[model samples]
Target: MAQRNRTAQGVLAALLAGTVALTACSPPTSASGSANSGGSTKALTVWLQQKPDTASALLSGTYGNSEILSVTQDQLVSVAADGTLEPRAATKWNLSADAKSLTLNLADQKWSDGSPFTADDVVFTLNLYTNPAVKSPLTTVLKPIAGYDEVASGAAKELSGVKKVDDHTVRIDLKNPDVGFMYTLFGATIYVLQKAALSKEDPATVASSQIWITPGKVPGLGPFTLSSYVPGQRAEFAKNPNFRKPVEFDRMVQTLVTQDVATQQLSSGEMDVALVAPTDVATVQGMQSKGVGTVSNEVPGFDRYTVNQRKEYLKEPKVRQGLLTAIDRVGIIKSVYAGQAKPINSSFTSSKVVKDGFATYDYSPTKAKQLLTEAGWDFNREFVIREVNNNAQRQAIDQVVLKNLQDVGVKATIKPVDQAQVTDMLTKGDYDIFLYGGGNYTADPSTNIPMITCANAFPKGANLPAYCDSKVDDLLSQAATSTDEAKRGQLLTQAGKLENADVSHLWIAQPTRVYAFSSKVTGGVRGGDGMFNMLMSVQDWKVK
Candidate 1:
């Protein structure tokens, strides 16, 4: 295996050197002609691992949605490459001393169709998000907003807390003090839609409405405008003429393809940017030695398996705990990730947030058997691993887990479903267990820790495990509302330790995700953080 890895690394280096040589020798201008801006036109092609259901952030939570929207839509605030909050549509935001209210000063901006963007857009978007019919995952994040419950329960048409002070300013009143509100109003997730164009459609159906789904019908306050979309294939975008800032690339395309295909395309110079699978880390690193492309692999991204507590046999905490101990995460990481990952004892990535008393589930076949027997686990029942077909690394990891389960006298099998059907399966509780892998959207624990709370259960938020503990929920709530940073950290640490003991979710390994950007593409952020932040400055990226 080591010999094959070395050979693969060698081949990857040669391919990258050859691709860079070709790019360096090519003509500057395309055969078509110069752009309307009188500059050499450059087009960027990006490969997304999954096909998105819609470009609208309100309607979709797919992996590809954020990448497209990061460039095609504008939010109130954006996180800078250095992890500081920067102004986008809204120039600045100020939180009241009591932390019960937030006032936002809007920037003088126009939508892509030349319509004015105002505080009304902000109010409308916030109220629309609370509409029960929308089924947005953000409802949990925005729960602290005053009047949210009334709007969510269908008792109110508009959120009374969101007031449009004037054309250029808005204020939001909260039911309780929440210091993490800014991060909750994250850039990639909270896009400001134009009220004039979208208010005509019903809030419930707007996400699926033709006006919003159609590429150019609804205008956006972004650097790029959606020009065309081909389901399961690609989405094309053009530079927004009405954008306030100058854009370097005239056009950009996001194509849906598997990770392997993306790697192949990158090596052949057919693709400019794409994610690298864990198994292919060595290959990409070899390519990076030639300096034709940049490889970024950052922490806080994880791979976990969610236990469907709704299942009768899986409800017992011991069963869940036993399942965790049976699999050797360290061995799997070495085998699947080539020692590029670390085993996570709790949901937190930072040691400071992980309480000293946090529970640990070390690999022990004897202990796993004892726990299962004590919980009266059924050995004959099949342990099905529900996962989609898009990620090859996940499939390889699950196979090892299945073998571990079988070794512990458990019958297990992997059920591969189509990527399109994953949402439905998760919503309907159709699986015994499933693989959940992704990065925390922000460094703030409040943004992700609530995912396991009861309020975030499936059909509303991302709590697919359906593991509810009142103590943990209270700690998270207190942490979210506290204005003191130290207090919040302490509360979150307590919650993490409690949930870890309960085995809410089988916390596995924290992965180092690898992404490759072509040498010609400049100004693209590293993929160490969420993918949204990676392309936050897509408009500034230029081809050499």
Candidate 2:
């Protein structure tokens, strides 16, 4: 995981005082004790902020859903804490010199049902994802492969790019060279499913079938297997006896809990681990210092306010720059996050290779006023900033932003809407500015730069800003195909610099993901994207 020192000293007393009434009950016994008590199974209890939408691993698109899927399914490759690729189902892989094809050697493993895992399973899994009937979000990752579009369009039954060489090997042919394709294989969206289970089902409806949605029905090659599931409530997992490595916990319980009360539940020992909200960081840190638990923080993602470039006033580069320079990002971090976050100058804030390479926009109210005046802003027009109401941090930050804009003689108002409505509003280009948060799935710039590219603009894609520059697009394309790491980093650095100069999106602060876990939990339970799966190494976790 990326490392950074915590700068703020948490005010635990004041923060915990508000939660006293909420956590009045006695602490529950640790899951470790239950296992040691000679029960039929040992379990570790975890609390999630929200319930997952689906139990099928491949169909899950949200981070919360990915967390549950990680424990129950194994990808062809796994990402190490330091972002290095490690073999999982595929023991090793060989890429062609031109980078147009890859050959994977399967591991000597078996599915949860003791069925042999073969290259055919890998081919079937990729084809299923690329099938238009399935309409999985993961299809984007495989779309670059040769003949993938044909298969996805229903013109072909199987991807011509994917071929099973034998029982232990498979070859994937790509339409173009993609340096980041190897990393894409490690994502939770791609998983090998037993072909036998889906042979008779319609690919479109497989996600809702009992065999896929019901726990213990779908065969997995993970260290843990789903034992039971309750929608919007909890899910239970048991150690897979056929796993290559010994699993420390015999059972794991995932419970649904709201973010506001997660810290209280953790403090009361109802959960062994819980993702603490930024508002409860101080209390959780205080608990950590008192030996109740430990808190791990990292730059897991970034939050930004995207300026709608399609707007007539925003079309001018100067106006966009003025709006961005007017905001006090540092002040917002200090006031809203209590210094829990760091100000970011670029959208790729979490990327160590490109963040520093981008240009910085220091807080300059005078410069902002000048630029706005030059762009012909009358200072009488009121702009609406749309934000999701559920995000307490963003709501607080928005208030600060409103004051900053007012100070500069620019009129603005905060329009709070349902979290579900924000996306539709953005897509419809109904807001002048929209607040959003996202993280790069992989370490490469190719994973994130596309969001602001012209191709992803509203009505067509996720580029809410509708910002696009041919120069930046060229740089991104060059970076995506480059095999040399240093050259690729240089190209991406150039792209970041271009995007920063364009001022399409006002980069705010990179939020730290705080994970509070009981001291009893030990092992390599760290790394990867903090927001997705903090327990990526749960197989190594041993409760004392």
Candidate 3:
């Protein structure tokens, strides 16, 4: 059981950054790493951002329809462009007699491996996460549910959070009520997994293991199957033949391609369907009615900056607040993202779909300077250091904040690094102010908020900023143990305000995820109310 090397893991993930390289034509890779089926001809073609550990972002819902699955596995929920949650997945749900349990009645379903779907699957999945040996990032997301750790630790006889009485019926027991529970449940963490398949791998490695998910062996209950994985070459998937639901396309082929190549191939009609970004919409859209494809863009999750509170300079509340007031979120959305994103009002996206009543940062240089001065910085003092990437957005933001800090005579230095180095400093707690994004919440605030307590199941606490608040800890503990949703939300709201004011994080804007598709392609896209998770019921999707 060798630990995964941090450096290696970061590098592997960073490789996904170069999506433009994949747009070109190249011979598919050898079968040494491919999971393609034996002589299966039925499939579809999707040009993906990069190769994935399990399924590509297109399959996972992190992209568009794939992003939806992360919110809730049930197909009934939809995310509005404003980043709110709508109904999908479970048709109806209920809380228990003591208000500690939530029971759900699912819409129709089946596993991609053709196994009959059942509540036993849900129970098994949750129980697996509770296992200390499992070591999934998802464990922290499930913290709001009661008795998860107990069952995982084998201290409790059964999982108190989720119980299965029969197929299509799932009951979730919470230690307390959570206001944001439903929103958090919409993401991929809750998607079903097969017990028969999971038993094959080492639990800790399950996060990145490929045996159960290879093209020849995936049991996922998603719309498509892994058809081919030719590393540094191509990845292709086709509709599930045994899929309980009907798919539109007979065959789909995906290449290990990027935005640049895909756009070129698509523009030339070499690629049939693709996601054209907003910046390039002119090229794709210029042909609207004349071209073979259509374009779409929508606001999604809020991407923000994180100050590793575990670091020294950011420990001062004023310094953190200073950074927040220093940048113009509106300019970043308009200039860097080209108006595709909306400046966030609260750390929660400005989208009304979520209805979050949390503290928000109102851009104020005066307030930031006052806070910095209160933290004991004279006009001659140099107290802040910034670690950013070597990108236009990072450089632009650094410049803005640096200029503002100098206005108050507090010297701030910005350091840019390759993504690999950034990852190292972020997780290892080595930076004063690091740019980090991901407070995109949907069902429950548990996964999005980054709160922590002594009872937390995660080896590391949530405040990647690494800040600790006893009151916040108490709230998280009460929320985790309580089955009451109302009380859970109350605690979360209280905690959110405290953290927001402390400025451990500078909440930014809700980014838009826009994609262009061929006129021939028809299916799900981004949501209107909540953040669109792309785990869509795309089996019925087809190309004309």
Q: How well does each candidate superpose onto the true structure, as a TM-score? A: 0.87, 0.83, 0.76
Best by TM-score: 1
Q: Rank the candidates by lDDT, best first.
A: 1, 2, 3
> Residue-wise lDDT of candidate 2 within 327-358, one digit each (tens)?
99988887777777788776544253556645
Q: In order, what is each prediction's RMSD in angstroms? A: 7.8, 6.5, 6.5
Candidate 3 or 1, higher lDDT: 1
Model 2 segments more than 4 A misplaced? 1-40, 55-60, 184-188, 207-213, 288-290, 295-297, 310-315, 349-357, 376-382, 409-411, 420-426, 458-464, 484-486, 527-531
* Model 3 CA lDDT for position 377: 54
Q: Rank the candidates by TM-score, best first.
A: 1, 2, 3
- Indicate which candidate wins on lDDT: 1
Candidate 1: the clashing residue pairs are none
Per-residue accuracy of model 1 over 1-544 as CA lDDT, tens digit each: 0000000110111111101100011122221223222346677667654455555556544455555676778878765422357688889899888788999999997899988888889998887777888765555657778998888888998888899899999999999888766655552256788888777877777776656448777789889888777666666778898887888777777666656666766676666777676677667767764444654654443567778887878878899999999999989988898887888776655444755776679899899989999999999998898756645666777888888899999889889866556667777888887775553433456645435778766656656677888899999789867878788889988887887888887877866766777666765446643344466667666666
State the TM-score for model 3.
0.76
lDDT of all the models against the reference?
0.67, 0.65, 0.49
